[model samples]
Target: MFITKVFILIIIASITNINNTSALKLECTYREPDLHWEAFSRDYTCEGTIRLDGDDENIRTVTNTHREQMRNADVRGLMIVQQRDLQKFPKGLERHFHHLIGIDFEDCGLTKISSDDLMPFKELLQINLSGNRLTELPNDLFQFNPKLKKIDLSGNLIMHVGLEIFNNLQHLTMINMHDNACTSDNAYATKKEELKELVWELSVECPPTLDMLSSSLFGSKEFIDNIKRISGEDSDDVRNELLNEIQGLEKIVQELKRRL
Candidate 1:
């Protein structure tokens, strides 16, 4: 009887462990890649779009499987939506979707994006990052994506627009900037002649000099907080050092302007 009881207990423990492992596994469907219309341009083509929609864990699993299946596909666009658990932009996507022309991360919980996140999308034409938790955009966010034509940044928490952000983006004709925290304005170029006016309007809404300085020097408020946490008592010294660096950069900029 003692031996039988011990066997039963072991079996129960094994079953419990199996159940826990199954519970921890993310559940998602791996559907075959379909020829769908691209979200931004509404173009119908087999290689136009790949939609990945789920919570972060499920999407991650699906993305991995899809990447394998679409390894040889000439994928031109990607859309990831309803991902509340996705706080940062998924890196290394350009590895598989190098030919991607448009990317949509709508309704995701993305809080921030860096220049490096977009550095690889050189052939990108349009981007829709609406309905995210983004509070600010990096200064060089679009530096590498010079071929970009359209941008949709509506429905975010962004409060400022930097003048330098749009520099050299001559091909950019439309910008959907409505419903952000800063102002309810949309910039559209009806004709080539009107594009300059729209661009100027976009630049004029930039945050003040002090705010721009903070953003340019530190990248984001969260980064400053992280530095404070890591440096602790030396945070003040670190901040002063950064300010001095900013001053030096300003002097260089002024000299360059004078020379030009």
Candidate 2:
């Protein structure tokens, strides 16, 4: 009888532990003006900032309670940090705090973000997405956030950035692209006037396309087969054919160069 009672107790404890692990824990704090000035000095507001910290379960599960908390706060800035399970921008925040002017999503494990994720934040003035795993950004990611003044994309794995990504961002003043995979001398710019020069430099360093003819010729099956035949056998006909092809290619190159 005692053994059966102990077995029942073990089962109850296991159930309790499982329930605790699955529970979402969300902590929201309202920052007053004195506490918000350091992080949002450029765009300080009387509404202050609402900082939200949560575990993986809290991040994945957005309940009506969470939405009510943010709605009641009505802050201009929203900060969510250290959510490792967050692989993309949480669309739930937009529904709860669409009037947010600034957002800080640092140290999240974000791998991808689309334009739709940010289209709702039309009043956004600044965004900080540093220390994530982002590899690329869409060209029209900021089309809706025209009032944006500062952007922080540092400490990510972004490898390529299109010049079109900066289009229509005339109000942009500061861009922090440091510690990314694609680092150019002009990647970090502080002034709005330097945006044009930055785009020109990035274009020179990372062109949008490669020489198609050269790339195709080197990777073609016919080119590989011809090379193997020339090296494996002593066929004078094959050797002469290759030499004539090389001479013709040289003449074409010379003609193209003359035109240039």
Candidate 3:
């Protein structure tokens, strides 16, 4: 669901009598005389907007719910800006925000990410991981985020992702994967076939998602074999076969829906 908090902020935005207006809206203001801060204006387009800020810190550090800086009311549309040591995926955030709607980790020097790292924020609609050192995406990357609508993975070292990493993101509309190592279909590249799988899943109609229901309904043998082949060799064949089945089933479901 689209967050009502943003609307509420917009409703009361004109109240000049309020002591703290920044606590209501989603805007980033930059300090003058700092050329580095000026760059943030260009980097984060939202910085130019005149909305009341969430009143978040200049550096949003989220380790746990107990942190003095982390407040429950300000969990929506949070941004962690320019923290170089935020290399590893910080756990326990999921425990705090049961349905975190928006998150921005721009230029935070992120190195890795896992499904568990985001599972806590299951209802996240937008996520920005631009400017990171990520190399490979896990198979279950979006296993927990079915409602995710937009994700920015630009400017990362991402090379490998499963054929089905995005198949289950039911509401995903916008995804940016630019400047990554896996943008090639050339066999000589790091993982050509894996990247090809991502391309195959770029668009769709009706239902627009694949999940356990389709997995159980089709390609049972290949799915079973792919599970075992991971421990052995020749996983590509089984994995591709199952992915093809999943894609095919999605089309069949769409076609069936059209007929009705």
- Mind giving the per-residue lDDT tens digits that candidate 2 earns over 1-260? 99999999999999977766654433455443454323454432233222233333233233233333344336577666777766756555554454778877778888977678888888888888989999776556787889888888888887655545667687888887778777653477876567666666655443322232233334356767888889998999999987876687667556645653
The predicted structure with the larger lDDT, 1 or 3, is 1
Superposed Cα deviation of residue 87, candidate 1 (Å)? 1.5
The sequence of per-residue lDDT tens digits that candidate 1 reaches over residues 122-239 is 8888888889988876567898999888888888888656656877687876777677776545544545666677557655664524455455655655557756655776667667
Model 3 / residue 135 / CA error / Å: 0.5
Worst 10 residues of 2 by lDDT: 43-52
Question: How high is each candidate's TM-score?
Answer: 0.58, 0.58, 0.48
Q: Which of candidates 1 and 3 is the stronger one according to TM-score? A: 1
Q: How close is each model in CA RMSD to the real structure?
A: 9.9, 12.0, 17.8
lDDT per model vs. reference: 0.63, 0.64, 0.55
lDDT of 3 at 200: 62
In model 1, the worst 10-residue window by lDDT is 43-52
Off by over 4 Å in 3: 1-74, 184-198, 201-260
- How would you encode candidate 3's per-residue C-alpha lDDT over 1-260 as one tens digit per residue? 35798777766775643435333232343221222222222222222122224443222222332334444444455566666656766544444344456667777777888877777776677778888888766656778878877677777777655445676876655666767665532211114354344446332211223342354445356666665675676667766876786688779767745764
| Higher-scoring candidate on TM-score, 2 or 3 | 2
